[model samples]
Target: MTVPVSPRHDETFVLNLGPQHPATHGVLRVKLTMDGEYIVKAEPVLGYIHRMHEKLAEASTFAQFMPNTARMDYLHALAFNHGWALVVEKAAGIEVPERAEYIRVITVELNRIASHLLWWAAFLLDLGGFTPLLYAFDDREKIIDLLERITGSRLTYCYMRFGGVYNDIDDEFIKGTRDFIKRLRGRMPRLYHDLVTHNIILIKRIKDIGIISAEQCRRYGATGPVARGSGIDYDVRKHEPYSVYPEFDFDVPVFNEGDSMARYMVRMHEMEQSMRIIEQALDKLPEGPVMAKVPKVLKPGAGYYYSAVETARGSLGHRLVCNGDKNPYKLKLRSPTFSNLSLYGEVAEGMLLADALALMGSLDLVIPEIDR
Candidate 1:
């Protein structure tokens, strides 16, 4: 005799995971449709910290707009400032002095290192490792000190002008950067690489998890380490070549693994490459005008211009639709974190909670940038 089986229903739960949780990073909420620990579907709900930066830019003058860029990515404010300034300079066809260009390159690269160090620290913290955060902060403080001396600000810096930098670098500033670079170089192997990269727990946690292929990355417009980890050679600095980057020699690190660990390795190697760029730039540092001559009150002709620069996270683009007026007609920013976050829904499907957090961390989503 055989027993007849009855059609049965399995209960499911709708989980509101974050928006207040420590793992969410900011005021980020994830609505998850789940069956036990595995996520059947995931939706990232944004707008928690919306500031309407694009619309606000339209009401401000070209020169007045530089400060707003810093508010988007508080971690890499200079990159945003540089991105907007470069676009405006290109649009207006203003020539930046050679010295100004080198200073821009050096400062941006140093900010990149600072940004990556913070990421490294936060990433390790996400994995339940705390020591790397302290070590990373120790290195980052030196960069902050050097930048503050020249820029007169630290976190949300407004140092880049439309045609050049606000101030020139002094001997003390140069010496600070050079010494900090040497210190970071010496500590890289012992503190960063050995401490986290060699940690068996970290390796096991990230490796072979949250795999994203090259095709998916391109489809989603993913840039930076997330895209390069998928074997795509798409660094804006190399491919587009802006702001004296053409004069510098550096390699864009690529990894074919397309996993979280690959993303980690790519960023780690990128830190080293940033150091190389800085050293080269310092060696060839020259004496010249640091600011380009431009009228006190500026206005560009009516037209839309788009420009991009590689930030610590990835490619940052600015779209300005100018009306030839003092104020912009319209403005938009293509933040890398926005595009990188777009891939989250597809990548997080069917993943466990731990794996999803790893994937989210791998994308390096900056909430302000996303909401801007």
Candidate 2:
């Protein structure tokens, strides 16, 4: 329903787009000012899911805060785990083993694919398609099973440790990943691209709808698919180059359209790139111990340390302040969803209510990360 905006009406109405609505995707409420079916403004109300994550980090030891990272962005918990591990390792001067680095890369890429799959399913659902959700979840289940073999948990994983990962990938896991990669590559063209990407309805609903200029993305600090869709080409893994990511060769997808379809296509292409990375990591998988040698007590020098990783949404960063104590003095998280959602108020204005929801879904928000 791409309803055109009418001239300024004599009256407008206020609508609450739910703290419990499915379209909001979490405990988020958007106070939308509407002129008929056109949105005049959208203000997202947060804090429904806030659990004082940073405060918990300050109160607990460095190791104690590991599980909390997963809870923030439950779908892409591995990226959060990787970011925390990197910051702690940076502060403690810990060098990870070569084999462990490769393992981390493999599992993280797997998690990224799982995240994008979930996003695809949910986004399609938002647009009133149910069959794709079933197909996407059927594929995502394989990734979860593979990760569950090593990580031991399904949704929120604390698999990564300060120097290395909690467990190593076995031969079965390797074979399973390879088989899944082959299966997905074959299905992408028939199941996803031909079925959805080329559909005239989806293209018309998303293409050139809710156009966001590159300058608007910069002003709001939007990253991940949102920024890349606007042709920014800023990926933390490629531009910042952390962990074993530099060792893998992959292309960062960039689309200049700056619309919902552009963002959707960016993620669709990113899943393929992630598969390429996983394949390369498995090919060059080194043989050695997964864990590095380190002391039990982790107390870095009295200073500030920072680390960032490319998560499914965008750049997830952790800033740590230490006083040479077992517990961090201060912990701050830079979650990309917060920055991406911040621009909704500006962009949603004058857009049809349905189109605004499409734009919001394109941002691929995880509310716990923003509320954290």
lDDT of 2: 0.93
- Pick out the ten consecutive residues of candidate 1 with the lowest summed lDDT: 1-10
TM-score of each: 0.96, 0.98
Candidate 2 lDDT by residue in tens digits, 1-372: 344566465688889998999987899999988998889778999999999999999999898899999999999999999999999999999999999989988888899999999999999899888999999999999999999999999999999998898998899999999999999999999999999999998998889888888999999999999999999999999999999888888999999999999999999999999999999999999999999988888999999999999999999989899999999999999999999999988888889999898888889999999999
Instruction: Report the error of model 1 at residue 296, Å.
Output: 1.9
For this target, which candidate reaches the highest lDDT against the unseen true structure?
Answer: 2
Residue-by-residue lDDT tens digits, candidate 1, 58-80: 87788888998999998889999
List of clashing residue pairs for candidate 2: none
The Cα error of candidate 1 at residue 90, in Å, is: 1.0
* Model 1, residue pairs in steric clash: none
Say which candidate scores most in TM-score. Answer: 2
Question: Per-model C-alpha lDDT, please?
Answer: 0.87, 0.93
